[model samples]
Target: MECVWTRNGSRCGEAASRRCDRCRAVGYCSLSHQVSHRSIHKIECDRFRRQMNRADVLSDFPFTFYVEPSKVQVVSFEKRCSFLARHGVHGLGMWICECSCGSSLINFDTISFIPDWLLSSELCPCNEPSISLQGRLSSWKDYCEWRHLPLSSPAAVILHWPLTVYWAIQLATGCNLLPEIKNELRIHYLGPEKELLQLAAFGELQALFPGVRIYIDFVGPAIPDRRSDERIDLHSYALCNDTACRCKTEMVSKSQAVRMQLHAGFYHDRYGEFSK
Candidate 1:
């Protein structure tokens, strides 16, 4: 039987470097990818091997991961904490988050954000305070170490400010069950104290179910009424927070492209300074 390694809906054929003699199910295209994956794969490789040995894989059916907008929801977290009636979320709920990696668990209030459609101008209500990226990297390194994640492996960054909303949505749509599913959703909130508030359990699920397709679809482009753009750079920029502010580039900057690039770095350093 041919060995197949599928992650986050992306497929990698049997590579000499990835094959594990002990577990025939999981193989990587390169030793580095396999080595980086050992943290999670080591625990589940045995089970996956047993399944593969049974000839459970369907031939001619290439593995795939799917991401669809309907599966995700964004909620409001700030509202639930505010005392002023007008400050909190109109409808708020509490929730708890657990890392499928068995690393840690967190509890907090939650809310949901529903995209306009494939694309929409969604507002963000997070702390607009400035921070130092260098400092953030210091702390994030600790968090990653604590969680046993590869320092170089892709990791998601979540802000601590909008805890309630992020938590609520995360609970509603547990993390992705496959690597591909997990990779599709990379959302970020702007705030200091970057605390990986939520990620679709993408890494864990991918490690556990290598063959499953994971998809997280957000209502973005293709919606006739929504001017959502697949190219984030084209999205309009506006203040996400409710705070009043001028539209000056320094006082206030908006660019989907810039924001997207920052998203990855933000996870690495939750609260770091941004230079113009």
Candidate 2:
């Protein structure tokens, strides 16, 4: 993947001269760019090191797939605030999740206010909020602080497909893929989903990538309730050992990921209290 440079709203690369000697990750067309970029580069370089060390942090299991953001799309202050204010009545909003993978994931209807996690992330992009995700104004002429600081809870949902689906769909479409993937990663693959949120993400991806096939087996004990939220009440000791069976062969990998469809109605809460 080639690194393309965008400056002054125009992209230029391949012809650029100076490059970052540290990771050899970025390039500059002039000395001014190098100097101006140093502050951003210092943090980026440290983040790069942490990403490299992620694998060293003890693994609970071998990774089967991993998905990350392809691009950083910024929504303006007006757009973000308006969206949130309108949607607040429903306790829904979107926030940015800057994945360790060097991409930013847009999480919609997520329950958060300041998105402090994003602010604390190494991928915050800039120290000031004026430079919001979309490169819009950092300081509000009226309020005086960084634009993002004064902003109330997020208004619009930052829709995001499951990390798994994000990668799967990209691999399938090829053209719709994120530019960062083409430039940075040599091999981008989708791993298995264990958490319910991850599984939901997979379901969304499946909807998007209709062409891709997924094989699931009824390995867990049969539960009378197929409801998605009912999963929490299901037996926790379920296990499957039929390695020679066709189901095992069809699955992404025997121990890679687990899949169990939950009934709908997960978005709403019912039966206010415990019923006999």
After superposition on all CA atoms, how large is the RMSD of candidate 2?
Answer: 22.9
Q: Put down candidate 1 lDDT per residue, 208-250, tens digits, no spaces.
A: 2223332221231112222222223212222222234331122
Q: lDDT values of the candidates?
A: 0.29, 0.29
TM-score per prediction, in order, is 0.22, 0.22
Candidates' RMSD to native: 18.8, 22.9
TM-score of 1: 0.22
List model 2 lDDT by residue over 81-198, tens digit each.
4443343322211122322221133332231122111121121111222332332211222111222322221211221323223434343345443352221221211121112222
User: Alpha-carbon error at 254 in model 1, in Å?
Assistant: 8.6
* Model 2 misplaced stretches (Cα beyond 4 Å): 1-79, 89-157, 160-202, 211-276
